[model samples]
Target: MAEEIKVIVFGLAHEEYGIEVDKVRTIERMMPITRVPKTLAFIKGVINLRGVVLPVIDLRGRFGLPESDATDSSRIIIVAVNDLEVGFIVDSANDVIDINTDSIELPPEVVGGIKAKYLRGVAKIGGSRLLIMLNLSEVLNKNEIIQLEEQEV
Candidate 1:
């Protein structure tokens, strides 16, 4: 039997979420962000990752949560979305969990304000806590992301 694919999961506003570990390039702490005007409210700003500039999105803001200050636990999950490299700021980065295909289940019709189409599935880790598996492509599409980038310009 083939081994299960492990995903690096994180939390945002008390909700659990995960992404394929392979897509994640690296994780970094909160850095100085050059604020860009007229961009979406969810977008914090762009960050200089080494030599490359990557847009950083606040997951809490995107999910319509109350604004909170970044703490030591705050982290940016650098991921490649539709060939565009972007970073997502989350409350905290959790452990890398191994979840087999069998353990994954499709999300319900409604998940807060998030549509089910954006979710890959839901993984029940322990007893009551559920981890939402995210489809990066759906979550961050090329066309829409480009529009957001254009607004920054």
Candidate 2:
């Protein structure tokens, strides 16, 4: 039997993307983000999640996709990488599915305008569905993580 891994699937610009469930802390509805000055264009800002203030990034902007106003379906997926927790603002977070490890293939140079460097792999699921796996470490690089940490305090 092929090894199976669970993933949290989210939508961005009508495309489906996934992140390993182990890396996800929680998924929250769209919340108010307090914008900070001088941050990158994609860095939406920080949001007070429960008691912890987490930096939020607009995935659409990060991936250079067309932006849409947040609707009730919008979500913030909190993921932890290298001990830093950050929230990704997505169009919607609507599924959790398991995929066979053997089904994952190396990403092409670019997928939906996002560079392969920020992608883990691509997986085919549900017969005709394609899921793009996110490489969180690359999406939030060491330097970017440091910048996010500074946004905390």
Which 10 residues in a row give candidate 2 its minimum summed lDDT?
144-153
- What TM-score against the true fold does each predicted structure earn? 0.87, 0.91
Each model's lDDT comes to 0.84, 0.91
Candidate 1 stretches with Cα past 4 Å from truth are 1-3, 145-153
Q: Superposing every Cα of model 2 onto the true structure, what RMSD results?
A: 3.5
Q: Write the per-residue lDDT of candidate 2 for residues 1-82, one digit (tens) a residue.
A: 7899999999999899999999999999988899988777788899998899999999898777888899999999999999
